[model samples]
Target chain A: MIALRIGLAALFLMIAVTVQTSVLTNVAVAGVTCDLTLIVVIALALSRGPEWGAIAGFMGGLLLDVVPPADHTAGRWALSLAIAGYIAGLIRRETSGSPVGPLGVALTVVLGTAVSFFIYSATGSLLHDPSVDWGEFGVRLGIAAGYDVVGAIVVIPLVMWIMGRVQPARERRRVAP
Target chain B: MLKDLGSPSRSTSSRSTAPRSAFRSAGEAPLRSAGTSRDVRRRRTVLLLVVLACFTLIVLDARRSAGSPVEPLREAAAGVFGPLESTATSARQPVDNLRDRFAEMDRLKAENEKLKKDNEDLTRELTTSDYARNRAQELDKLLKVAPAYTMTPARVIGIGSAQTFSHTVTIDAGTADGVHTDMTVLNGTGLVGRVVRTTQGTATVLLIGDRNSTVGGRLNASMALGFVSGRGEVGGTLDYKLIDPKARPKVGDRIVTWGSSGNAPYVPGVPIGVVTSVTANEGSLGSTATVKPYVDPTRIDTVGVVTGPPARAPRPQLTGKGN
Candidate 1:
């Protein structure tokens, strides 16, 4: 059962990473692209709990870091994903079913995006270019939040269904001769 | 009840052993059970490692102050995705072709009408005052100020991916076509940007209206100089410390590049934009004016890189100075 869960998580992470870097990036409305990988990590964390969530987030983030445009160093994404996963897991434990689960995922996505922007801007400021314009930053934040929320709505339920299939059956027993 | 009390110590010991047994079983459980706390811990550790990696990269990238090593990765990604982009572009080609046909037909009709009007205007000019002829001669002289600074035409290719910075655009001309870093890119009306990055056949231009873009410009009528800085949306703000607070810069006043020193980055007299609005703060020393850029960056299909003439040699110092 444990092995099966790990495999499922690994497979989901890979798909999320590939889709984010390739397809979702091209699906921008206005100038904002959806962060699909972030949504997947948050959804998984909310559904299956934190430990798995953090693991999935770490792997997803690592893959994103290594992918195209190679803007930042490797560890930046790793840390951000870990924090996002941990936060989502905490929210899951505190929330209940139905709308709350999806809501939690949405909130996690927003929080994760905010943290990313803040960290990236602070880094840019330290780097001296200081490209962070307050007005533009606020607009971009709203756009990113909107994209993530929409992504969460679609990804959460789909992920939940997949998780249901991978979950172990407690009632199954071994047959003896 | 008796059975329960009789095995109280045994029960407690068994209870303690239960968690240990569960932990041991977790190690051998099938994949479905992998969501256990132990595995979660491992994942969290990995996440931390990834974040740390990104942080290190940001720091190093900022410190280098030069081009990023990420270029190769960007190029590779562009290469892999190039085919997909081409396919998407191809799919829209038919619609584009139709649009082009309609546009060409409209342009031809406009030209026909313009020629008819020009013939009438020329007839009037011949019978009227000689002012039109004098104006033409002056225009010819004005156009002859620098005959050497011709233009090398190029096409727009792609835009940058990052949303925070939209001031950059990619062009098909590069060093091979005399497009160098800091070389000015212009359209028919005015300056667009300066080339920043270049490859064998491509270059990235930083537009004047980007938040990071700034240029030295002067009002054509007043010769009042100021530095124009981008406000990030579609316009730029001009700043000059010497300007008065109540300075009234009317709309439609042309602005032009105020050349830097001999090694100035941009050529002088390249039209930038017209003053759109002017406002003065009550206590501020200088007035602020908004200038709408001359070139519409979004619709730019073609551009030219200006390779201006070499600097003039300094005149020799006078040997016979007055005593």
Candidate 2:
């Protein structure tokens, strides 16, 4: 079950990150690319709770950080995404049956995006980069958050279905009753 | 149906890891979230390790002097992603061209660069033409100035730039053309070196830019005497130690050869070069300046050799051009 889940997560991460870095770079809206990797991480987090979610987020974020055309400090994204993913898991743990409404997915996406951007900008400022153009940065973040929210509705359910298909027999038996 | 749709989002259909005993305790909550303290501790440790690993990577990248260890990873990613990006762009080109006149900005940028390069080439051509026209007038003036000494025009077959160490050239005019060793050489503007060696058909003329060569020189404005010698590179220098301490030669001063005895090696009143930089002498009690030569040794193509004695046939009266 663990192997199957990990394999599926790895595949999804590769597709999401590759598309986010390569394809989405050109198709920009208001100078912001849709962070599909962030959406995938959110979906994985919602599907799996804190521990696995944090693991998935760390690995996914690390890939994003190391890939080519990466301009910022390495590990900045890793830290932000890991925390965001963990928070997402914690949200699932706090809520019963983890609900399916678009409202919930949208909130998680916005909140996750906000957390990631906040950490990224804060880390940049701390590292002596004077990222003082709040107006432009804020607009991009806002657009990205909105973009992620829209992606969440489709992503969350899709990821859940895939997870169900790949569920281990032992776990499936345990949950069947 | 809505219940199934809503509950399935939690991925409850996936096999649960929790025991049935814990399942009743947790009711509908996911099993991983309701873990023992051991699970909590393990999760904390993994999270901490991930953060620590990330922090280490950040520090490693920041301290990267030339290239980071992860550079290969980035290269591999680029190798993978670059072609993918290219493929996507190519695929989109047709659809893109159909809408909004695709790649307008790209075409404009290319056109801008081409226009900029064209403008630069045109400007360079105009400058070259202006230089050629002015050089023609200077050569014409030379004929009127020194009419007594017969001038043998020889094409500069080889330039000093072809040689690594010495500023010397082989001219087409040599012994066959009445050229010999020690004949004074000049071009449209000023002093080229005298003939150093001559073969059956070609001669090598030493230029003032040669370190072994020096010319007895006089400043045009102050009549101050100094020796101009080559640095064996491009320009020569005017020795200031010989000049009187009271006299100061300013920048842009003209230097002309103060003719050798009987005008054997170099003729008199021939312009050598112009002063470009003046600096206080480090060890001596005077100022020294660099002179950019009138004839660029590397660019010489056509030259004249004085085959005989100084122009004693009634010196041409000094005119609008300098003596």
Candidate 3:
């Protein structure tokens, strides 16, 4: 059952990455875009718990880094995402009766955005690109974060509903017998 | 049937066993001990993974030329989820189609009205003056000296995700259309970019304005040579040594490609841009200039790929005294 969930998550993650590359990128909102893959990672983390979330985040981030025409180092994304996942998982553990619905999603999206932007900023500073001005960084970060939050609000519930329906009831029956 | 045979004995043994409290205490002690160790180990593992990821990024980025082995893993992930991507795209196609239909109608109406007015204006202008004829003659002369390069038109399919550092565009032409790595791409007016990667039927072009993009260019009128490097924005900077500090380059001077060393990549004489501004510093030996690219990359629909040797080669050195 664990393997099945991982496989399903991986499949969805791939879809998210491809769509992000091909379609969602073209649909920009005020010169900013929603990172759909990030939304997927957060969703998986929330639904499947922490360990799986971190793994999914790492893989998804690597996929995003490799597919895009990026100027930064490769593993920058991998590390950022792993940290995001771990943090999200920890948050999940701490919150109680946290209505696993819209409120939960909003929190996850906001935190994920913050973590991604912070990691990128640190990495850029280290790289010494003179264009890494704080003002521009703040604006871009806000745009990305806003878009991601919107994506999470819309996508998380729909994914949860789908997973709930498709979950393998047969496994529970096998264990009982 | 095997479960049924063992079930009776299991129940009987449970009834005959020592009190539940005795077993419970023993179980609790070990469970608590094991849980703490497991938690510690898990935390250690997570920390180790984070450290490794950061270390790898730093080491790889410090290299003069770096490309990560993680690319294959990314590709594999994409391949695995290709089907889901298609489904999502298809799901959104209906709405897109509806929006496009209305937009197309509006565009056609505007185009028709503009064309009708243009025809009347052209007819009146042609009768009144020889301006069109003179312009055509000049254009003909220019064409003879430097013929327009061959082109393979392409449609932009995608743009880069991270807009902070560089700008990239993906086009619908690739190796199948005779496109190759590092081939110069140009729109009607000037250079656009070079092909970075190619699949069977699609290619990604790294735009000239991308932070990493650099091209050898020269001023058309003065023949002043310089290297044009992207400023991580809409414009590029010309870095060149001027023999005279007073060599003031005026605005609107054309910039053209100086070509490559051996011409395996870019062909020469492709228009790059026009000088928008120039600044000279007394402390510095050379001046810096800004270039406004002729092609508005945001609206580029069709582009030409220049193929062949560079227009000029390095001058050969005389062996002894001048003949």
Q: Rank the candidates by DockQ, best first.
A: 3, 1, 2
Per prediction, fnat is 0.24, 0.25, 0.26
**Better candidate number, 2 or 3, judged by TM-score:** 3
Query: For every candidate, how close is chain A to the native chain A in TM-score?
Result: 0.80, 0.90, 0.84
lDDT of 1 by residue, B228-282 (tens): 7776563334332224444456666667676555424676556777788766756
User: What is the two-chain DockQ of model 3?
Assistant: 0.32
RMSD of 2: 22.3
Model 2 chain B scores worst on lDDT over the 10 consecutive residues at B157-166
Error of 3 at B265 (Å): 4.3
- Can you write out model 2's per-residue Cα lDDT over B1-323, one digit (the tens) per residue? 22332243344313333443354665554454556344555656666777787778777776556666666655465455444443444444576455453475565445545533443453234223423254445435544554355567765543322112245655666677798878889876678888876654556687877666788877766668888877655433334323576577778777777677666687766678788877787777877768888776645655778787635522233334545
Encode model 3's per-residue lDDT on B1-323: one tens digit a residue: 22442244334333423342254477675574465346535644664566487568556654635555654543443344333433444445575456566685575455534433443353334323332243454334333433333456665555565434456666666677787778887765667888876655556688877666788876666666777766655333333334455565677776677676554356555667778887776687667678887666555545555544324332111111122
Residue B10's lDDT in candidate 3: 35
Query: Which parts of model 3 are misplaced by more than 4 Å?
Result: A29-31, A100-104, A124-135, A164-177, B1-40, B50-54, B57-150, B198-202, B234-245, B300-302, B307-323
lDDT of each: 0.57, 0.63, 0.60
Candidate 1 stretches greater than 4 Å from native: A1-105, A151-177, B1-37, B66-94, B97-142, B145-166, B172-178, B200-202, B234-248, B259-265, B281-284, B296-302, B307-323
lDDT of 1 by residue, A1-119 (tens): 77877787777776665555434544555545576677777777776666666667776765555443233343445545656765676555444222344555667789877765555
